[model samples]
Target: MITDGAAMGRKSVGKEYPSHGSVLGGKPNRCVIHPLQSSMVAEALERRNKDWIVRTKDATDLIVQVGDFSFHLHKLAMVSKSGYLRRLAFAERSGEENGSSLKIILEDLPGGTKSFELVVSFCYGGKIDVTATNIAPLYCAATFLEMTEDLQQGNLISKTEAFLSYLMLSSWKDTFQILKSCESVSSWSKELLIVKRCSDAIAWKACIDPKAFATLEEDEAFCLTLLANSHGNLNVEESSEKWWFEDVSTLRIDHFVQVIESIKSRGMKSELVGSCIAHWTVKWFSRITSGFDNLTPKHLAQKLQRITIESLIKMLPMEKNSVSCNFLLHLLKLGLTKQINSEALSKLERRIAFMLEECSVQDLLVKNYGSKDTTYDVGIIIRVVKTYALFALKYSEPRVCIVGRLMDGYLPLIAKDTNLTVDDFKSLAEALPTNARYSDDNLYKAMDMYLLAHPNLTEEERTNVCGAMQYHRLSQDARQHVMKNDRLPLKIVREFMLLEQVKMARSITACESNDHPRTKTRTIMKVTKGLDRGCLTPKREISMIRKEVENMKMQLDQLQTCKVKLQRQVKRCIK
Candidate 1:
C-alpha cells in the first residue's frame, strides 16, 4: 500500500535519479557493455560436452551447472558471495573421492541461466549492469543465492534493491517492466515483496495527476498517438483519467489485481477505476478466440478464465455507470460461460440490471454456445430483468420505458431461435412493470415472431407467450397484422377481437358525446372522478371514445367474418 505520506516522501528522492528513458534502449546513451567479462562466462558455459577449463592462473575446481550450461570457476570466489554455495561447498559428498572436481547442480535457480550468469559475473568482480529488463529477475536470483551485505560489502542484494527502489519511485514504465519480469520468478518476487512494491508504485502513479510530471519523450510515452489531448504528456486521448489504463492492463491478473486494489484504496474515482477495468477486460477479449474453451487442455483454460473473471467481477467499482452497460453484459455472459462464483456473478447481474436501459438488442442477445442450451441465453437476461423489476421504483419512468423498448427489440431476435421455450420467453416479456411500455406494438411483433418460429407450440403455450402484451396498445398496422397472423392462438385472436370491439364501442360513444353537450358534460363528470388514466382529459377522452365507437360499428360488420377466417386459418396451420 502506497500511502499519501510515503508517496510524498518518494517525490523528493525521485528527483535525485535521472528521468526514465534516458538510460534505456532507443536512446544514443545505451546501457554499459561488459563484452569481455560476458564472453569469458559465455565461453566457459558453452563447453557442455567437456569439463570447463578456465584459462586462468589458478585451476578451476568447481563446476556449477545452471540448467544445461556449466561454468568452471574457483570455489573460493563463489563461496565468498553466495551463502547457498558456501553451505553446499562444504557439504559431505559420499560418492565423490577427495581431490576430484566438485559439481553442483542448480535446477531451481530463479531467473534461469541468463540471470545466473549475472550472479556469476558479480561473484568474479565483473561489472553487473542492472536495467529495467533484468532488475526483477536479477534481484530474485541474488536473493536466492543469499548475496547479502552480511556476506560481502556492497553486495548484489543491496545494490539491486537500491536500483529497484529508484525505478519504483521515479519511472512509470520501469515499474511495469519490473512487475512483468517477475512472472518468471513469481515465488521469489513475492517473498521479496518486489511484486507488491511495484504494484504500489504503479497504483500511486495512476492515482496522482500526470500533469505533475514533465512531458514524456516518445519512447517513454504510453500511447503517444492515441493521446490527443496529452500535448506530449501522459494523459490518454480516450480520457485524461485513463492515462494508466494501457500500461496497467499489460500486467497479468495477479499483479493487475494488486495495483487495482492499491488504486481503489487511494480513493480514486470509481468511474475511472471502472473504465480501466473495462479497458483491461476488452483487451483480454480481443486476444481470445471463441473462448477459453478453444485453448489446449480445455479444463485448465476454463478454470483459469473462470478465476480471472471472478477476480475482475470482485474488483469492479460499486458506483453506477462506472463501467459501460455493454461491457457489463458481455462480462455477465462470460461469467455464466465460465461458471464464476455465485456472489461475483450476482454482483455483475445487479450492476447490469441497474443500467439495463443503456443496453441494446445486440448486447442482450448473449448467444448460448452450449450443446444443451437454447440458441440465446434467455435465463441470464431473464434473471437480470427480474432484478431490474425488483428495483423498478428506484428508476425513472423514461428509463423503465427505455428498457422495455430494449426488451421489445430484443424479443424479436430471440424469438427466431426455435429452441427457445415459451416459458422463458413469457417470463422475460412480462418481467417489467405493467406501465413500462406505453405501446405494445413491439411486444406484439415479438410474440408474433416467436409464434411463427415455433409453429408446434400448443395453443395454451402460444396464449401464455402472447398474454403479456396489451392488445389495446397495439397500433392500427399491428392490429391488422395480428388479425392476419395465423400462427396466433385462436383464443388470443378472439380476445384481441373482443378488446378491439370494446375500444371501438368506446370511441363511437365518445364521438357521439362530442356532438351532444349533455353527453359531453357526463363524460367530464366521469373524468373528474379519475376514471381516465395517463394525461387523458374529459374532452379528449369523450372525443376518442366517440371516434372508437364509430370505428367499432364499421368493424363489427366485418369482425365476425374476420374472426371466422382467422379461426379456420389458425386451425389449418396447427394441423
Candidate 2:
C-alpha cells in the first residue's frame, strides 16, 4: 500500500486536477467540476509547474528578451500569439541558418519593462492580469506585437483589447476621465482609434446634454494630477460629477491640444473651453515657475515646436469670450521672439486680424466690462492687446493689415450687429480707447453706413437702433443726429421732441416755484411721462434736470434786479 501511494503521487506530479480528487484514498472518481475551482487549479499549475509550454529554451528555437529578463520560448508558441514575433522568428530562423535560437529584445514598449512583461507573459502562460498600472503598456505591447483579435492563445489578443476598450478607453466618458486617461497613455491613443472613438462618444453626449461636460470644469484633480500624485484618490462617488486661456508649458501640449480639439469637434460651448483654459494656464505657470518640479520632459525648450504658434492659435477652440483672447495672447507671446520669420508673421497677422475681425470686439468689451472681475480680466486683456499692438507696429504691412481688419470688421460685424442693444452701445462708448482703435470720424462713418445700408428698418428695429443712440453714450455727432434728424425713425424723432417738451415744462415750473402748486405737479407729471417706456437717453435725462435747476437760478437773478428797480422808484416817490 505504501509503494502504491508513492507511485500515485509520482504520477500526479504535473497533472492538473479540476478540483481536489479522490486519488489519495481510493480510485479517482470523475472529478466534480466547479468552474471557479477549475480556473484556480489551472492558474496554480501554470505558475508552479511552469509547464504551460516546454521551457527548455532550446537554442533550436526563439529566444525572447526584455531588459535583463530572458525567456527561452518555443517558436511555435511565440509565433502563434504574435505576428510580429512570428515574422521575426521565421525570418531569422531561415536566414541565419545557424542552429542557435534567434534572440530578440523589445526596447520601445511603453510601460517599458511592465508593458513587455504583460504581453510576453501572455504569450508564455496564455493569461495575464490586466491592471491600471499595466493595462496601458499591455495595450501598447499587444498592439505592437500585432496580437489583435486573434484567438490563438486563449484569446490573448481579444483579452488585451478588452482591457483597453473597457478600462482605458471607456474611462473617458467625461472630460476629467478623458484627460486623466490620456495623460497616462500620452501619444499612444493618437496611434490608435480609441481616443477618437471616445471623442465621438462625447460628441454624442453633447447632443444629449450640452452641459453634460460642464461637470468636468469643477474637477481639480484631473488638471493637477499629472504633475502631482495628490489628486489620484477619487472615489466612484466623487468621479460621478465630471467635466483655455493659456500659459502653456509644452510638456503636456500634445494632450492639451488633443483635449481642446476634441471639445471643439464635439461642438462644446467654446466659453467653457475659454474659462477652463484660463484656469489651466494659470496653474501651469505656477507649476513652471515653481522650478518645473514634477513637470518633466524638458523637451519644451522648443516651445510649441510640434505645432506652429499660428497653427495652434488658429486651431484653438475659441468662444466669443475674452478668455479666448487670453489663449490668443499666450500664442502671440510665444511667437514674439526677436527673429520672427515673415511666414510666422503672416500667420500671426491672419490670426490677430481674425481676432480683430471675427470676434465681436464691442461685444467682448460689453461682456468683460460687465464681468465681476473686470479690473483683473479687462486689465489682462488691455496688456495683451498692447503687446499685440506693439507687434503690429513692428511691421508696417502687418500694421496696415491690422487696421484694415479692424475697420472692415467694425462696420459689418460690430457696429451693425443685427442684435445690437443699448447696453452694448453703452459698453462700446465707455470702452472707446479699447474698442475704436481709430478716429471718432471713422466710428461715426461706420455707424452711418450701417444705418444707410439697412434703411426701411422696422419700427421696432429702428426704435432699438434709436434707443441705443438716445440711451447710451455715443459719439457727439451720432447723438446730435439721432436726437434732431427728420430722416430718423418718426417715433425716435418724437422721443426727443417729447423729452424737450418735458424739459421746458420742468424749467417753467422751477421759475414759478411751489407757490404755483398746479404748475409744480404738472411739471412732475410731464417729467414722469417723458421717462416712460424706456425712451430718453440717460444723458438727456440728466440734462433735463440740470436745465430746470438752471432756469430757477436765472429767474432768481431777474427777480433781484426787479427788486432793485422798485427800490429806486420808491425813493423818487418819497422826494
Candidate achieving the largest TM-score:
1
Error of 2 at 179 (Å): 6.6
**Candidate 1: regions farther than 4 A off:** 1-46, 50-55, 68-70, 93-97, 208-239, 290-296, 357-379, 390-406, 412-424, 433-442, 449-461, 470-487, 498-575
Model 1 per-residue lDDT tens digits across residues 466-524:
88877768888897667556687766665565555555545544545245657545533
lDDT of each: 0.72, 0.46
Candidate 1: 10-residue stretch with minimal lDDT: 21-30
Q: What is the TM-score (0 to 1) of candidate 1? A: 0.70
TM-scores of the candidates are: 0.70, 0.45
**What digit string (tens of lDDT, one per residue) describes model 2 on residues 304-417?**
342444445555554444355435555454455323455765554455444653444442342222343322223323333443454454545644444444543443444454
